[model samples]
Structure formats: C-alpha cells, structure tokens
Target chain A: MALCNYYRKRKLMDNLVGWWIRLMVFLVVALPLFITASLLSKSWLILGHISLPELLFSSVWRPLAGEFGFWPFIISSLWVTFIGLSLTAPVCLLSAIFLTYYGSRRLLGFMQPIIDILAGIPSVIYGVWGILVIVPAVGKYLAPMLGYESPGFSIMAGGIVLSVMLIPFVLNILIEIFRTVQHDLLDASLSLGASKWQTIKHVVLRKSFAGMISAFGLGLSRAFGETIAVLMVVGNVVGVPENLFQPGYPLPALIANNYGEMLSIPMFDSALMFAALLLMVVVVVFNMISRRTIIYLESRQ
Target chain B: MAMETTKLSIQNLNLWFGKQKILNNINIDIPENKVTVILGPSGCGKTTLMKTMNRLVDLQGGARTSGKIILDGEDILNTRRDIALVRQKMGLLSQRPTPLPMSIFNNVAYGLRLKGIRGRKKLTPLVEKHLIEANLWDEVRDRLHDPASRLSIGQQQRLCLARGLAVDPEIILADEPTSALDPISASVIENQFFKLKENYTILLVTHIMRQARRIADKVVFMYLGEVIEQADVHEFFNNPKQKMTRDYLQGAFY
Candidate 1:
C-alpha cells in the first residue's frame, strides 16, 4: 500500500514538471510575438488608410498639409545602415581573424578586454564624441578636400560614427565564433600545405560564414535602431540625400525628433507607431533570415 | 632489401613544453617508400613525433625544440625554409577526419587550387584521379558537389585521404587515422596504406599492436618519450630487442 502511494506521487510530480516545461517553451516564443502584435494592432486603424507603397517610395512628408510620404526617412535609414555595414564589416572581420589566428598571446590578451569594454560603452557617449571630435574634423578637413560646405552634419558623419559604434559588437562575436572552428580542422589545413591565410580563407572563414552573417544581421539591427548618435548628426532633414555628403533624416532620427509632438497632429501618433512597426519588422526579418541561414548550414553539416 | 635511402633523418631531437620534457634525444631514420609504424602506449609522444616531422609542432605556444630534422639533404628545422613548402612535401591525416567545409570535389581540389590550378575542366580530372587513388571515388562520384561532411565518418576519413593525396606529397603522416572508424573503414584505410607505400613514404602512429603487425613494414616502438626498438616488422614481432618491446607486445601492461 505504501509503495503504491509513492508511485502515484512520483507520477503526479512528473506530470506537473512536464506541464511546466511545455508552458515555458510556449511563453518563450509567444510572449515577444504577442507584445509586438499588440503594438502593431494599435496602429492598424490609421495604417489601414495609408498605402504602404506611398509610405515607402514617395519622398514628400508634409504634416500640416496632411501629406505623409515616408520614402525619404526609410531610404535614409537603409542608406545609413548599408554605409555603416560596408565600413564596419571588412575592418572588424580582418581584426577578428588576425586576433584569433595570428596575434601574439600578449596582444590577444590585451585586445580582448579592450573590445569587451568598447562593447559596453553607452550610445549617448558616442554621440557626444561624434559632435566634439568627428564633426569638427570632417568640417575642417574632409569637407574642404571634397569641395563641400562646412555643415559637417551629414549622412557620412552618421555612418562614420555608427560604424565605430558597431565595430566592437561585430568583432567580439566574430572572434568567439572563429575560435570555435575545430582545432583539428585547423591542424588538418596546416598539414595539407595550406598557408595561414589559405587556412583562414578556405577553412575557418567558410566554416564560420553563417555565424558571421548573423553577426552582420545583429549589427544591422543595432544600426537601424540606433537613435541618439544618429539624431545628433543626421541634420534632421526629411529628404532624399543625393550623396554621402548631404544631410539626411533616417527613421530612428525621425521618430526621435517627432515622438514628443505626435499628439498635436491628427494621425501623427499612428504614423510614428507605424514607423516603429516597420523598424521592428525589418530587424525581425534580418534576424530571422540569419537564424534560418545558420540553421540551414548546420543541417547540411 | 639491401639498403634503403633515408627519406627523413631525425638526430638528437629534443622537445620541451615549458620545462616538461616530451621528446628526449629521439633519433630515427625513416626509409624511403616504406610504411614505418610507430607503436606505443598513450602519451608516448607518437603523435608529437609525427607532427614534428611536418613542422606542425612549433605552432603550439611555448613548445621549444632543439633538433636536426634533415629531409632531402636539407635541414627542415631551419626557419628559412618555407613552412608551406615543407608541409607540401608531407601530407597528414589527423585522429578525426576533418573535411574542409566544402564540396567533396573541392576538398580534394583544395591543395591543387592553392598551387594555382584553375578552371573546372583541369581540376575535375585531378580530383577524380585522387579520389580514385584514395578508393573513395565510386561512393562519392555521384555526389561530387555535395558537402564533404555529409558522408559517414569512415567515408570522411577516405575523403581526407583523397585530399591528402591530391597534394602530391612524397611522405604521408597518419596520426591514429583509423582510430575513429569502424572495422570495415579501418580495413579500407589499411589496404590503401599498403598500396600507397609503393609510391609514398608512410609514417603511421598507432597503439594497436594488431594493426602494427598487419601493415607495418618497419616498426619503431616508443615508450615514455624514448625509442626502445627500431627493427623490421617481422623481426620485431618475432624477436623484440628490448624488454619493454616484449612486454608491450605480450600485452603484459599497456
């Protein structure tokens, strides 16, 4: 009779634990989706009337005349993101590869903690640095060389600051992933008469391509969502930029510059919400694509 | 076997890893076009000796060496010799089969490509030839473009063998190559080694006495960072020179 009671109690505890695990898994996936869905629904009423193509492609966005074209801000966002990525990718990747494969022990030990500290720095500080240092340098030297006026508040400035901001984020992740490439694989490459460069190129980089892509995705997401540094330099102009030298307004900057006065205008709050929704979607899509690519590559392996 | 030319000669080789002696005054003359198996217990530095031949040992941090490793009348221990060039003359198979992250064809073609061989037409035949030589072409012929990692562990080992062969190395260094494989795969690798000995100098490291008996043409028995015996495979098994060799062969204690 006692043994039967013990068995019954054990079965009940197992059932309860299983239920708890199931609930936790469900919440992990569902919670973020639910919150984002609720936010999106809140903006749906006004967003329903505005054609997405107009918001995406049209350049003019005048609030008093009831014109709401978001092309300029969205395009600027994409422009700055691409510019930052283009600047940051090669530098961080090369640094990461060198540190992981060829750097001396003392150098590697010194650089790793420095990179960690860089990653932990606040965004607002980067903005201050850009204003006090980069802006003046560009205005005094780079702009004059390029035959441009001394405004210094341009897309190039934003991209330059953003790239510096993203270096540590991308490099730290890449170094770790590069380190995880199997030691035996490295030995195999070296033994096969491959030079250090060849080994890194054909083996280590190829093996970690998916992880690198994800790092890029994360960097892109951060660049897109970054507000303070970009707001300080992007000139706050809602227009299409002709070149890197021209001042422009990206989405995050637009939202930051407008969210305070959103309540005064009709449909303004909904439009800002829509912008937030678009930002969320773009980030989510980039992250999902990276995740799926990694999964696909892993499955192949 | 009147007299075989020494393909690689190690004289008074000593290695230290931060005050801990790993290889102590080792001396061995590896003959040309022969399968020389180094048999020893775990931690006997068999793998270390093989790696040292290919100059892969110095890659380890704090690994210090004092030795004269002469290959083809040149001292390979000299830093002036190109490491890539040194490694190119010797192919290595690690304990686990590590296929490069690429197609089966590319894995074999990697070394060839590094030597500036280009164009699909040129590469395809050489890849096929090496694959055939490694005895893996028939199984992988249909899936040449597929990822090399998709194959079984045994097949991967064969693929790695094919990759090593494509480099045209005169010497092949295999460190416990078949240790990770099943019996059938092990036999396949062993058979390849037997055939490959006619063209290439094969240096195999293994603790398995049965395997040493099966494939070794020349045997070098090592124990505790020292070589106890160097003899013909038949004589060594039938008549071991040293007490340690006898004890090791008798399965007295590993």
Candidate 2:
C-alpha cells in the first residue's frame, strides 16, 4: 500500500510540473492575440469585404467626399521616418560612443535612471509635450531666423518628437552592442599605434557594423509606425503640403482614425485594412533585412 | 652609465589595488637586447609587474602604487602623456591570441597608418617584412587581404607579434604569450622570441618552467606578491638561494 501511494504522489508531481509548463506556454502564445483580437479581427473583416482593384490603387484620403487616397499619407510618413531616423541616428550613435568610450562607473550609474525614465515615458505624453513646446519654439522663434513662414505642427514637429522617442531605444541597443566589443581587440588596436579616434573609426565601428545596422533599422521601423505622438502633433492634413510647416498624416494615424468609422462605410474600412496590410508588409521587409544582416554577421564570426 | 644603455629599471616597487596589496617591494633591471622571463604561481604579481612597467595597471580604478619605475632615466608616473608614449613604445601581447578584426595586411599596417603613413606601396612591403619576421609570411602572404581572424590560434599569435613589431616598439612585453597554444605552437613562439630579442627588449611572464629554461636569459621568481629570487636561468635552476625558491623548484607548490 505504501509503495503504491509513493508512486501515485510521484505521478501527481510530474503531472503538476507538466501542467504548469503548459500554462506557461499558453500565456506566452495566447496573450498577444487575446489583447489585439478586436483590432486584428476588425481589420480582417474589412479586408474580406473589399474588392481587389479598389483597394489596390486608391490613395486619395478625402474623408468628406468619401475618397480617401493614401498616397499623401505614405509620402508624409516616408519623409517623417527618413528625417526622424537621420536625426536620431547621428545623435544616438554619438551618445553610444560617449557611454561606451568615455563613461566611468559613476557616470554610467548616474545615467541608468535617466535612460529608464526616458524609456518609460508614454508616446502620448511626448506628443503633447512636443506640440506645446517644440511647435511654438520652432514656429515663432527659430523659423523666422531661418527665413521660413510657419514651421507649424507638420513634419518638423512630428520628426522631432519621433526622434526623441527613438533615442532611448537606439541608445539601449547600441550600448549593448558597444559593450560586446572585446577589450583584447581594443588593446590590440591601441598597442598597434592606433590613436583613440583611429581605434574608434577602424576597429570599434568595424566590429559593430551589423549590430548598428540592426539597431538603426529597428529605430527606422519605430519611427515609421509611430502613431500617437505623430498624430497629436501632425495636424492630420490629408494632402501632402510642399513645406515643413504644413500639416500631415501617416498610415498609423489613418488606420486609427478610420478603424471605428469603417462600420458605416465597409468599403472605406476595407480600404483601410488593405492599407494596414501594406504597412505590415513594409515593416516585415525591414525586419527581415535586419535579421538577415545580423545572421550574416554571426555566420562570419 | 645609465645614459647610453639599460632599457628600463624598477627600484623598490610596490603596487596595491585598493586595500589588497598585489606587488611588494619589487626591484629589477631590464637590460636591452635580452629576453627576461618571470615565472610564478597563480596570483603571484607577475602580470601586475609587467603591466606596471608600461603604466597600464596604473589607470584601472582604485589601483595604487609606490616606489619608482624609470624608463631610460625618467620616472614613469611623472605625467600621463609620457606614460602613453611609453605604453606605445612597449608593444604588449596578452596571454590570448589577439589580432585586430581586419585583413592580414591591415593587421600589420594598422600601426603604420596610425603613424600617418598612407601610401599602399610603403605599407605593403613593411607589413610583408614584419609578417616574415613573425614566421607567418609564407603561410599568409598570398592572402594578406583576407581577414586576420581566419588564421589558426598559433597563426593569430604570430600575427599579433607582427602587429606589435610593425609599431616599431623598442621593448616587447608579453604576458604568457603561449599559454593558449598547443605545445608545437608554443615552441615556435619561443623560437620567435629568441629572434625578436636582437631588436627589442623582451620581458615574458610564464608559468612554464621548461619554457623559461629554454628561452629566458634571466629569471625572476615571484610568490605571494613578492620576488623571492632573481638570477640567471642556469643559476636559478641549479642553485636557488631561498627556501621558498627551493620548494617551488621541487614542484611542491605547483
């Protein structure tokens, strides 16, 4: 009887462990789908209802006449992402250099909390802050000096906010990449008569090239998809204006605004879903390229 | 007497990393054109002593030092700029094989480029000569443009030597240059050290006694942050004066 009881308890314990692992796996795989089910399902339903040709070439984004062409949004978004990454890349790259090369223990210890705080700041908060602070600062003061009429809540504001949001992300990734460079290689380069700057140029950057590309791609993708911050400051104009001071709209904002209204105009809603699908493809391509680069680098090493 | 000779001298040297003392009253004379081997057990201040000669250990946080180290009659701790120049003057090869992540040619040419030599024709032959001296030329000369990291462990160590020599350093400081290699490669490295000493003063720290017997002109025995014995290789092996040295020689501690 005692032997049978011991075997029964052992089986129970093994079953408990197995059940616990299954629960963990369920949480890992099911949580994201559960949370985003409404949005995804809505997009899918709209996608199924729309005809093929109308979804393919419709770029007009006129909400009043029900003609919502998405070309202007695409153009504006591409430019914003380009400008945001261009601004973020150099500053974040330089910051990563400072963190890795010049930082003492005390300096890094002090910077940790600041980076955490920046990383925790909400996108909407950045949007509101950018509108209140940057728009006027650039519009009333900096714009007049630069000979521009009105540098309003347009590309300039959106780009600045997007850049700020991407800084912490880029910084975090780059800091790790920079830290992974071996000290022996650093010493090897230094003892070889390479000056500090020369070492940075030749060995430091050379070793981290793939990782840097991955980080920059991630930052670019974030800027491209950034919605709340861009929406709050972008002034939500439909047509592409010629200058930086004019209002604009991008894909994420268009999707967010029209996802609810698509119930009334199912056709327009399907068109929006198709837009989401297109943007997803773009991001997927970026991610694939980044992964390929990282994998290629790993294979070389 | 000191003006025209004597590459470096250490007198009454003591080093401490914070509260933990690592080197105790070390004294030695590093002669020019000869290879000196320092043999010790683990945590015996041998590596610390090598790093101190070029002031590499001095920059690490909380590391403190006393006494004097003179390189060609100048105090090592007098200034930072001069210390850097001395560090540049002494090419350092760590225990592991460390080549720059570059082409075989660039690995050797890296130092030359730092000195502001940009001409390809000039850099190429100089690199070829140093690689030949390092005993890696015949194997790698055909693929100088290929990455240096693709070479085997022994080949990488030789490439490191070529890089060090390319800098034209007056002295070479090696901290266990062959502890990472196989026996045959280790012997090959020992041979290169013999050839290299004709031009550069070589100070090597080794845990291998046989290697020291084969290559070292002078041997310094260290234990527990102190130098227990210093003598010519033959003398130290045949007749160690101190009791601790005798015990170490008998392989009791190892």
Candidate 3:
C-alpha cells in the first residue's frame, strides 16, 4: 500500500510540472500575438475616424486641429536609422576582424568589459551626453564648416548619437560571429599562401555573411525605435527633413512626447496607439525577413 | 637507390613554447622526389616539427624557435624571406580536410588567383588539370559549382589535395592525411602519393606502421621531441638503430 501511494504521488507531481512548463511555453508564444491584438484594437478607433491613406501620407500633424498625418515622421525615422547604420556597420566589422585576427589576447580582454559597460548604459544618459557634446559640436563647428547656419539639433546630430549607441551592441555580435568561423579554415587558407587580410576577406567574411546580416538587422530595429536620445538631438520639428542638417521628428519621439497630453485632444489617444502599432509591425516584419534569410543561408551550407 | 638530392634540409632545429621544449635539436635530410615518412606516437612533436617548416608555428603565441630550414638552397627561416613565397613552394595537408567556404572549383582556383592569374578561360583548364591530378575530376566535374562542403569526407580530402596541388608547390607536407578517412579513402590517398612522388617530394606523418611500410621510401622515427632513428624504410623496419624504434615497430607501446 505504501509503494502504491508513492507511485500515485510521483505521477501527480510529474503531471503538475509538465502542465506548468506547457503554460509557460504557451504564454511566451502568445505574447507577441496578444500585443499585436491589443494595439490593433486600440488603433481601430482612429482608423474609423480617418482613412488609412490620409493618416499615413499626410505630413501635417496638427493634433488639436484634428489633422494627423505621419509622412514626415516616417521619413525622419528611416533617415536617422539609415545614417546610423551606415556609420556603424563598417567600423564595427573592421574592428571585429582586427580583434579576432590581429589584436592580442590582453587587448581583447581589456576591450570586452568596456564594450559591456557601454551596452549597459541607459539611453537617457546617452541623451544627456548628446546634448552636451554632439549638439554643440554640430552647431558650433560642423554646420559652419560646411557653410550652413543653424542650432545644433538636427538629423545629423541624432544620427551621430544613435551610431555611437549602436557601436557596442553591433560590435559585440560581430566579434562573436567572426570568432565562430573555424580556426582550421583560417589555417587552411594561411597554409595555401594567402595573406592574413586575404584570408579575412575571403574565408572569414564569406563564412559569416548570414550572421552579419542579422546583426545589422537587429541594429536597424534598435535604431528605428530609439526615442529619448534621438528626441533630444533631432530638434523634434514637425516637418519633413530635406538634408542631414535639417531638424525633424521621428515616430517614436512623436509617441513618447505626446503620450502625457494625449487624453485632452480629440482622437489623440488612438493616434498615438496607432503610432505604437506601426512601430511594432515594422520591427516584426524586419525580424521575420532576417530570420528567414538566415535559415536559407544555413540550409545552403 | 642512386645518389638522392636533398630537397629540404633541417639543421639543429630547436623550439620552445614558454620554456617548455617541444622540438629539440632536430636534424634530417628529406630526399627529392621520394616519400619520406615521419612516424611517431601522439604528443611526440612530429606535427609541430612539420608546422615549423611552413612557418605555421609563428601563429602560436609565445612560440620561439632557432633553426635553419633550407628549401632549394635558401634558408627559409630567415626573417627577411617572404613567408608567402616560402609557403607557396610547399603545400600542407592538415589532419582533417578543410575546404574553404566556397564552391569546389573556386577552392582549387583560389591559390592560382592569389598568384595574379585571372579570367575563367585561364583558370578553367588549370583547375581541371589539378583536379585530375588529385584523382577527383571524374566525380566532381559535373558539380564544380556546388559548395565544397556538400562533398563526402573522402571527396573533400581529395578536393583539398587538388587545392594544394594547384599552387604548383615543389614539396607536399601531409600531416596524417588519411587519418580521418575510411579504408577505401585511405588507400586512394596512398595511391595518389605513390604516383605523385615521381615528380614532387612528399613528407607524410603517420603512426600506423603498416601505412609507413606501404608508402615510405625513407623513414624518420621520433620520440619525445627527438629523432630516434633515420634510415631507409626496409632497414628502419628490419634493423632499427634505437631500442625505442624497435619497440615501437613491435607494437610495444604507441
């Protein structure tokens, strides 16, 4: 009777544990779907008030006047993210290669903790640094050097700051990816009379192509949705920017800046929720595409 | 055998990794156009000694060596000597066949392109010739554009052999080339070496006594980072000068 009772208790414990694990897995898988559903339902109120094209393509964002077009904000977000990525990709890739192939072990060890610390710093702190350093440099020197006259807060300043923020994140991933290329592959190339630089270019870079794409994809998503640091330096002007030097406002800055006062304006809460929905959709689509590309590349190998 | 010309001469080679001696006072004369086998148990520094010839040991941190490795009457160990040129004249096959992350044809053509050869017309024939020389042409000619990783393990080794041969080296340094292959693949590589030794000097490293007897024209036995015996293959097996060599031949210990 004791053995029978022991078996019954063990079986009950196993089933309970199994159900708990299944619940956790279900919650994780459903999280994105739940978020999307809530965002869609909230944004539906604004969609009923205005046509989708008018809301998306119009540049005039007068909340009290009941006009909310997102064209300028969308364009500004794309420009800042593009400029940031263009600046970060080359430097991070080359630095990773150097660290893997040429940098001494002591140097790599010293650099790793520095990169980690940089990644750990909050975005608000980055915003403060951007205001103190990058904004002044752009206003005082860079604009005048290029024969332009303006206050420092502009798309270029925001891009510079965002690029700085992205360096550690992207660099960490690139270094890991480059290191994953097998050492024997390097030895094989070297033994074939290829120069070190040649081996890096042909073998290491070629092998890690998919990983590089994913790293850049992640960097793009992060830069696109960044709010505080970009808002501080981007001038937050409600207009389409013509050049890197022009002041403009992006989507995340829009949502973050107006969320407090959204309740007072007509249909403003729905508009801000719609902005959040747009941000979520774009990031999700980009991540899905990059993941598919990675799977394809791995399958080909 | 007629008077054999030395293709490579190692004189008083000593190597230390942070004060731990890995190779000590090694000397050998590797004859031209012959298969010379270096037989030893694991951790005997036979692989390290081979790496020193190609200067791959330089990649290891804190590895210091003092020696003269003369190849074709030139002291390759001289600091001013172009390491690329030294490596180009000698092809090395590692224990496992490592194909570059590229197509089969590109793997063979890579070394040729490094020498400044360009265009498909020029590369196509040379690639084909080397593949044929490595005895891999018939199997892979139709799938030259496929990724090299898709090939069987045996085929990959042959592709690596073709890649090495395409560099047009005078010497081939194979460090246990067949150790990772099946018996059929092993015999295939051995047969290729027998035919290849007529034109290029081959230095093979193996611990298998039967393999050494099958392919070696001359044998150099190593033990604990030192050369214990050097002789013709028959004499080295029949009458080893050292007790360790005799014991190793009789399978006393690996």
Candidate 4:
C-alpha cells in the first residue's frame, strides 16, 4: 500500500510538471499573436478612415489639421538604419577579425570589460553623449568641412550615434561567428602555405558567410527600432530628408513623442498605434526573411 | 641499402608547452626521396616533432622551443626567410582530412592561386594532374564543382592530398594520414605513399608497427619524447639497440 501510494504521488507530480511546461510553451507562442491582434484592432480605426497606401506615401503629417501621413517617418527610419549599418558593418567585422586572429590574451582580457560596458550603457546616456560631443562637432567642424551651413541636429548625427551604439552588439556576434570556424581548418590552410590573412579570407569568412548575414540582419532590425538616441539628434522634423545632412523624424520617435498627448486628438492615438504596429511588422518580416535565407544557405552547404 | 642524401637534419631540438617538456633533445636525419617513419606510442611527441619542422607549433600558445631544423641547407628554425616559404617547401597531411569550404576544383586551385596562377585554362590541367596523382581523378572528375564537404571521408582525404600536392612541396609530412580511414582506404593511401616517395621525401608518423614495417625505408623509434633507436627498417625491427624498442617490437606495451 505504501509503495502504491508513492508511485501514485510520483505520477501526479509528473503530470503537474508536464502541464506547467506545456502552458509555458503555449504562452510563448500566443503572446506575440495577442500583441499583434490588439495592435491591429487599435490601428484599424485610422486604417478604416484612410487607405494604407495614401497614409504611407503622403508626407504631410499635420496632427492639428487631422492628417497622419507616415512617408517622412518611414524614409527617415530607412536612411538612419542604412547609414548606421554601413558604418557599423565594416568597422565591427574588422575589429572582430583583429581580436580573434591577432589579439593577445592580455589585450583580449582588457577589451572584454570595455565591450561589456559599452553594450550595457543606456540609449539615453548615448543621446546625452551625442548632444554634448557629436552635435557640436557636426555643426562647427563637419558642416564647414563639407561646405554646408546648418544646425548640428540632422540625419548624419543620428547615424553616427546609432553606429557607435551598435558597434559592440554586432561585433560580439561576429567574433563568435569567426571563432566557430574549426581550428583544424585553419591549420590545414596554414600548412598549405596560405598566410594568416589568406586563411581568414578564404576559410573563416567563407565558412561564416551565413552567420555574417544574419548578424547584419539583426543589427538592421535593432537600428530600425532605436528610439531615444536617434530622436534626440535627428531634429524631429516632419519631412523627408533631402540629403544625409538634413533633419528627419523616424517612426519610433513619432510614436514615443506623441503617445501621451494623443488622447485629446480624434485619430491621433490610433495613428500613433499604427506607427507602433508598422514598426513591429517591419522587424518581424525582416527577421523572417533573414531566418529563411540562413536556413537556405545552410541546407545548400 | 645504399645511403641516400640527407634532406633534413634536426639537431638538439627541445620543446615545451608551458612547464611541461614535450620533445626532449631530439635529433634525426631525414633522407631524400625515402619514407622515413617516426614510430612511437601515443604522447611520444612524434606529431609535435613534425609540427616543429614546419613551425606550425608556433601557433600553440605558451609553446617554447630551442631547435635547429635544417631543410635543404637552410636552417628553418632560425632562418630569416618567410614562414610561408618554409611551409610551402613542406606539405603536411593531418590525421583527419579537412577540405576547404569550397568546390572540389577550388580546393586544389586554392594553392595554385596562392602561387599566382590564374585563369581556368592554366588551373584546370594542374588541378586535374594533382587529383590524378592523389588517385581521386576517376571518382571526382565528374563533379569538380561540387562542394568538397559533400565527398566521403576517404575521398575528402584524397582531396586534401591533392590540395597539398598542388603546391609542389619538396617534402610530404604525413602525420598518421591513414589512421582515420577504413582498412581498404588505408591501403590505398599507403600505396600512394610508396609511389610518391620516388620523387618526394615522406616523413610518416604512426604507432602501428605493421604499417611502419610495410612503408618505412628508415625508421626512428621514439619513447617518452626521446629518440630511442634509429636505423634501417629491417635492422630496427630485428635488432633494436634499446631494450624499450625491443620490448615495443615484441608487443610488450603500447
């Protein structure tokens, strides 16, 4: 009777644990759907008022006059992300390669804490740093150097700040990717008379091509959604940027800047919700496409 | 047997990994155009000694070495010549075949390209010739553009051999090249070594006594990071000077 009771209790405990695990898994899958559905329902108010094409393509974002065109914000988001990625990719990749291949143990040890601290810093702090350092440099030094006269707050400032913020994040992933290449493969290449640079170019880079793409893709998504730092330096102008030097407003900045005061306006809250929904959808779609590309590359290999 | 010209001579070679001494005062003369087998049990520093010859041991952190490795009248250990030049003179075959992450033809052409040979017309014949020399031409001739990773273990090993040979090295350093293969594949590699020794000096590292007897013209026996005996293969087997060598030959202990 005692043995039978022990077995029954054990079975009951196992059943309880199994149910808990299943519930956790279901929640993970359902949470995203729930958020998306709520966002869709909230944004439908404005979507019903105007078609998405007109809302996305028109740039006249007059909140008081009741027009909510998202074209300027979308373009600003793309330009900032593009400039950030362009600056970040090459610098981070080269740093990762140098650290992995030629860095001494002591040098690596020294760099580890610095990189951790960089990655741990808040975006608000970065914005402050940009305001203090990058803004003046752009306005006083860079504008004259480039033969332009304007306030420092522009898309260029946002891109430079975003690139600095993203360096450690992208670099950490790339270092791991480069390190994942087999040591024996390196040995084989070295023994074959290839120099260290040659081996890295032919073997390490080739082997980690898929990983590099995914790392860049992740960097892209992160850059696309970065809010405070970009907003602080981007001048928050509601227009399409004429050039890299022009002031522009991105989607996240718009949503964050207007969410509190949006309740009084008729469709203002719905428009802000639409902006959030758009950001979420773009990030999700980009992640899906990169994931598919990675899977395809790995299978072909 | 007639004495052959000395191709490489190692004198007073000692190596250390941190505080642990790995190769202790090693000395050996490798003859040209001959299969010189370094026969030893595991952890006897056979592979380390070979790695030192090509200076691949420099890659290991905390590794310290004092040695004089003379290759073709040049002191490889202390020479001002480029390390790449030193490595280019010797082709090393590791235990497992590690094909470069590329198509079959490209794996062979990689070395050729490094030597400044470009264009398909120049590379195709050379790649084909090396593949033929490695005895893999028939199996892979149809799929030269297929990824080298898709090849079987045996075929990949041959591809590595072809890649090594494409660089036209004077010496072939094969560290248990057949150890990862099946018996049939092992025999095929052994046959290739026998034929290859006519043109290139081969230094083979192995623990298998039967394999040493089969392929070795000159044998150097090692124990606990020291060279115990060195002689012609027959004499080394039949009349070992060291008691350890005699015991090892009789299968007393590994």
Chain A TM-scores of each predicted structure, in the order given, are 0.91, 0.84, 0.96, 0.97
* Per-residue alpha-carbon lDDT of candidate 4 for residues A1-301, written as tens digits (9 for 90 to 100): 9999999999999999999999999999999999999999999999999899989999888877889899999999999999999999999999999988888767777887899899999999999999999888888898779988758898889999999999999998998898899888998899888999999999999899899989999999999999999999988998998877878899999988978885898899999999999999999998999999899777655
Which of the numbered candidates is closest to the native, going by highest DockQ? 1
Steric clash count of candidate 4: 0
- Per-residue lDDT tens digits for candidate 1, residues A88-200, read 99999999999988987788999989998988889888999988887877777888898887578888888889999999999999999998999889888888788889899
Query: Under the 3 Å rule for N, CA and C atoms, how many clashes does model 1 have?
Result: 0
Off by over 4 Å in 3: A1-14
Error of 1 at A249 (Å): 2.1
Per-residue CA lDDT of candidate 2, range B168-243, in tens? 8989999999999998888888999989898999999998888899998889999999989999888999988999
lDDT of 1 by residue, B123-193 (tens): 99999999999999999999999999899999999999999998899999999999999999999999999
lDDT of candidate 2? 0.82
- Per-model root-mean-square deviation over C-alphas: 2.1, 3.5, 1.8, 1.9
Worst 10 residues of 3 chain B by lDDT: B76-85
Which residue runs of candidate 4 sit more than 4 Å off their true CA positions?
A: A1-10, B250-252
lDDT of 4 at A78: 94
Question: How would you encode candidate 2's per-residue C-alpha lDDT over A29-104 as one tens digit per residue?
Answer: 9975564564456456545644444544456555446554567777778877887898899998998898788777
For DockQ, candidate 1 versus 4, the one ahead is: 1
- Kindly report which residue pairs in candidate 2 clash with one another: A59-A69, A59-A70, A60-A68, A60-A69, A61-A68, A61-A69
